[model samples]
Target: MKIKNRTLLLPLAAVLCVAALTGCTRTSYAIQTNDARTIISDGKPKEADSGLLEYTDANGVKQQISKTEVKQVTELPK
Candidate 1:
């Protein structure tokens, strides 16, 4: 009874510790748009975000990306 509970507790504690240490790792990237202007996250080129780009992934459909998701700020053609 007590031994069984202790055994389960050890494994559960270990799992929780690992999860706390390694949460979700998000990487940010710069994406080029049809427009020459570059948009960056954090309102700066040197800043980073959770993900490189923020896009809506529909069922079996092309990814709908937002212009603001872009992580680069550059000049656009006039």
Candidate 2:
């Protein structure tokens, strides 16, 4: 019974370790508006044009905004 419990615990411990390591990775971005409000997005933004920017949100949907509406763009820490 002791040997059986040890075998199960070893695999469980490995899985938990992997999950914890992966959970620490989260990429976020910030878009500052002209009004001083910041929008936290899921990923980086793509340059659509001289006056337009595009990016995906946390819900996996694509979105676009005008560059004139943004004051600044930056990446958040992981």
Candidate that scores best on TM-score = 2
Residues 1-78, candidate 1: write the lDDT tens digits.
999999999999999998987665333333456666433322123322643444322232224345454534443222
Candidate 2: global Cα-lDDT? 0.86
List of clashing residue pairs for candidate 1:
28-52, 29-52
Residues 1-78, candidate 2, lDDT per residue (tens digit)? 999999999899999999999987668899999998887777788888567888887787888889899999999887
By summed lDDT, the worst window of 10 consecutive residues in model 1 runs over 39-48
Question: Where does model 2 exceed 4 Å of error?
Answer: 1-26
Least well predicted 10-residue stretch by lDDT in candidate 2: 42-51
The CA lDDT of each predicted structure is 0.47, 0.86
| Per-model TM against the reference | 0.32, 0.64
Model 1 residue runs over 4 Å out of place are 24-78
